[model samples]
Target: MKNTIYVLLLAFLTIPNLTAQDFSDIDKSPMDVTIIRNQNHSPMARVIYSRPSKNDRDIFGNLVPYGKVWRTGANEATEITIYNDMSISGQKIPAGTYSLYTIPNKTEWTIILNKNINIWGTASNYDSEKDLIRIKAPARTAAATIEDFSMAFQPIDNGANLLMGWDDTYVEIPFKNAE
Candidate 1:
């Protein structure tokens, strides 16, 4: 009985891939998170998104397409969490997590915050009725071509500008805390 148990243990240990985990390769578009902190170092807002590289492709109007709603990132739709009640472009938005969508154009972009956030990267899942706010942000030519889609926060008085850039186009949406 002891010998049989030892043999079984040895077979289990020698079994091919019996304990090995098969992990997939890294995602083509990498996920990222950006956050802004207030004067007290408390988080004001957070953005969870994926960065998609240019890969020598024409972004903006070509790949991303103008006048169409974009996921604002890759894979899943980009998500923004407002830590407090805030005003975006002078419109009030309650503190909550929402999906961030954008309709990019040559001169400007329409930034949309929707209550639905559980959907993947597809416009079919986007319901206009679920939209919370739609604000326009002016677009401009970047200093240089940005190889990857990126988002950042630039501190401003009483608020911050959520900056989005890809290729040679960029836009900034102002967000001010109501409280």
Candidate 2:
């Protein structure tokens, strides 16, 4: 009986795996810095985040579910740096680096700029007490699909329009330059 058990164990150990895992070659999301500059070509505000492709998947409500805190992008948590104090939505925010997070909904989205920085992924450890400001922004449906997640600055009179979009949906957070 002992010889039979040993023979069975030996046979099990001899089985081979048909596939190999190569972690080094796996593709990674690209890091991007989306910025807005003044007429002088100097950066006024910027967003540093990772860009994740849609890959033919639905983004809103499916990939990124509604009514939850999202990292605002892929990979590392999205970060925003302001060179000058600005008034966002209706809150006055000082010029500093902050962590950007969002809660998406069908009609509107809540945008948050927290004092927390250098963290990875969502508001897993989010402390609302550290939030500098939180405001609700209207959500819009894009006429065309955005294949990749993006944050852009559209220059206006005193400031630039902050735009976040993925798939066929988007939202805007307007900021007025404190100057």
Candidate 3:
């Protein structure tokens, strides 16, 4: 019985190896997540996005272009999950997951949150009708260069600010908890 059990276990492990599927190489733009918590340590929001490196490319106007909607990240559309209802641009937004899109310009950027999720890219089939919130954030040159496209949350008194940085540019979208 002991011999039979040992043989069965070996076969089980070997079978998996034999049937194992090949995986493609790692993504050029790897996925990442960022979360922000309140002072009490309660989660406020979460962002899942792919970070594309600068790779010595001109990001703002040349590569990303101007006056066009971008997926806001690489590969997959960037997703943000809000844990609480928030106010943006003096409008209330209910807590939920939304795809983040942006129109980049030299002066400012139009940031958008859409109801649609799981979108692969915005080049072909981005539906503007599903947009829930649209806000403008002034673009500023970063004091230091950011090597990768990155998203982060900066805590505020009422809520927090969603910050996106790439190359030498950065933008901030302010969010305040709805009273």
Q: What are the per-model C-alpha RMSD values against the true structure? A: 3.1, 7.7, 4.7
lDDT by residue (tens digit), candidate 3, 75-121: 99999999999988898889999999999999999999999999898
Q: Rank by TM-score, descending?
A: 1, 3, 2
Worst 10 residues of 2 by lDDT: 18-27
Error of 3 at 91 (Å): 1.4
Ten consecutive residues with minimal summed lDDT in candidate 1? 17-26
Deviating ranges (above 4 Å) for candidate 1: 1-24
Compared with the true structure, model 2 gives a TM-score of 0.82
Which number leads on TM-score?
1
Question: How many clashes in each structure?
Answer: 0, 0, 0
Query: How would you encode candidate 1's per-residue C-alpha lDDT over 88-179 as one tens digit per residue?
Result: 97899899999999999999999999999878995688888999999999999999999989999999999899999989999999999896
The parts of candidate 3 lying over 4 Å away from their true place are: 1-24
Distance (Å) between predicted and true CA of 3, model 3?
Answer: 26
| lDDT tens readout by residue for model 2, 21-107 | 668965566888989988898878999998889999978898899999898998778999998889987578898999999999989
